[model samples]
Target: MSAAGPLPLVGRRVLVTGIANEASLALPIAQVLRASGAELVCAGLGPTPYHGALSTAAEQYLGGAREAFESTVREHLGADVPELIADVTLDPSLEDLAETLRLRDLQLDGIVHAVAMDRTIRGGAAKPLLQVTREEFLDCMSASAYSLLALVRVLLRAHVLREGASIVALSYLGAERVMSHPYRNIGVAKAALERLVRELAAELGPTFGMRVNAVRFSPWSRSKAGGAIPGLEEAVAHAASRAPLGNADPASLGCEVVHLLRPGLGVTGEVRHVDGGYHVHG
Candidate 1:
């Protein structure tokens, strides 16, 4: 046979969420998608201009989140990449995102759900699940997991998703197993996220011919979220040692995302692992 030909993502429009900085997992995924010939839109978390009137330091901190994210996108995907500010847990921002895409005459072929947050996870330590408050737990769930449902709801309402679109969410092994690092609050949220993926896959696949899946990536302790979890670096080193293929890096994660989002894959509701056989150990 001749060459395999052009990249699978040629002409596809993909919305990639969770870019806060260059170190973000979303950045790598976005880059891969773009390289595969997809048009990209990036969404970063917010302390939007409307959050208004802060001290200079606060303004710089918040503004830097957006700036860093956009710069990373531009550096890799070029100046034309759409950049949006969104708080997926908030309906208003989600609506705005849908409107933004409509105004640009874009309909998404795929979405990379990379957003996740947990207030209880700190720099040097994370609060135990026993010590987590009700409000904190709910906040974690809403941001890290339920936001997927909210995003899909709003996007569908706006008809932003194509009839047979695909979706992939980033996840971790902590969703199903206790780990060396403290995964407490967010682990529960991830379990819910995985279930939501299956439910969405089952529901959307039949009615709209869409597919949704989650990827449990190898533990890499360098990204913003990964660095927040105490002992994650140690766990990363440990996992790399035990995993049959060693630690799967962000590029590997990106490659798998491209594979999942490709047209006609027909795989849905699966929590696929990209951790190089670490998941099989247990």
Candidate 2:
């Protein structure tokens, strides 16, 4: 232990997923985890063999996303940090990631699930729930909700996630309530994500000794996804005004996540609010 005392996550390895760019919430979370002395392995969405025959536009978009993710990771997290491309919506892509980790003999102590996507949200506007199609709904659900279960299942099957590992998923208050902004399809997916956290926590805790939890953060508009939601800026302003402690920043959220990720917390299946008392209002 140094003068500052022993790091809480010293010698632990964590997998941080869904880093789309430098403004991503996962970036701050990963920074906090590393500051606590954890070794990090990062995964970002990119084209995979499973995608199979993407249109030129789709390929270009994916390529740009991957490039941004790579640049952000290299600049902020360090070039040596292991980077893996994964499209959690694809089972084979997830399996490939697990295989790579397994081959490297890495056992993760924690996982940060920061991935969420909604095709129904476009051009800073969200389609009404009634307007959402089955395909759009399922696509949102698969990426934002089911991906958590899929990732954990693949990692567990590969024996890459160690016993007692902690898993934290990023969520929002919209999961449980209608927000001033249109959450629509993503809200439903978030609800499922939170439910999965509880169910997985109960099963994994008793059977595998793993912990699963989620953090609902403030109405942030800095990230790409957050900025794309119509009326989110207004929501952010309203939340800041109403919240007792104003609003929680990314650093605060990061700290909360790292606290949950710490070993032997005896906490699981919790939908924690890191939104500065915003979730308590009527």
Candidate 3:
């Protein structure tokens, strides 16, 4: 008998970021990636030196978030799966991450950019877009959109990201359309993120054989970030009813991501909708 071929992701090292908790979309994607024979390094949001001074409440919140991230990774991914603290909003933090990976001699094959935040949407309500302040707007853009470019740039400069690396960013339908829910500020950020995917793909593909793509997931309300978005529950229900395949679950989304992350694929600069054909509706 002939020898069997290796698994699609075997020997590939993939970094999955933005795993806030068990319900996070990144969790399932990481799970699928690992199952497909990829080595995983996970990063989550936490306090970084760039923050300077933090109040007691801020400290507590950050500490708690980090602890939860560690616990979740331990429980689901495994205790030995490497975990790193990263605040994508900070360039210093991103540089630190790149340095850490370089020092570890880890050359990444893929990156899952699953980070996003919107201060304009809080306490189960979204501030009117016109009412959003400059700081708030910029913060949203920095964390949700520009972080991809920043992270990739740092990795490329540090030589931590190998040529032909696959980069996937999570997006949503709100990027191009006005959702029934209040997607206001984050929607704009997602739109920018999608644009970054295309622009990066164009630049990176020919120059270094890298691929960049974004996936617009279904109206998910199980994650902490998703549940916090006002009217998302209604949006989820409405989407489930209207979508041809109901609602695409995290597992399906994971599979598609793994497909994109697979090396040697000709696909790039694509914004794929994993929302069960809901995006096709007018």
Best by TM-score: 2
* lDDT string, candidate 3, 22-48, tens digits: 999999999999988899999998788
What digit string (tens of lDDT, one per residue) describes model 2 on residues 199-241? 9999999898999999999998989899999999999999999
104-202: candidate 1 lDDT, tens digit per residue: 888999999998889998758899889999999999999999999999998999988998899999999999999988998999999999999999999
Q: What is the lDDT of residue 49 in candidate 1?
A: 39
Clash pairs (backbone) in predicted model 3: none
TM-score of each: 0.95, 0.98, 0.97
**TM-score, model 3 to reference:** 0.97
Query: Each candidate: what lDDT?
Result: 0.89, 0.94, 0.94
| Segments of candidate 1 deviating more than 4 angstroms | 1-3, 49-60
Candidate 2, overall lDDT? 0.94
Candidate 3 runs further than 4 Å off: 1-6
Error at 201, model 2, angstroms = 0.5
Per-residue error at 77 for model 1, in Å? 1.9
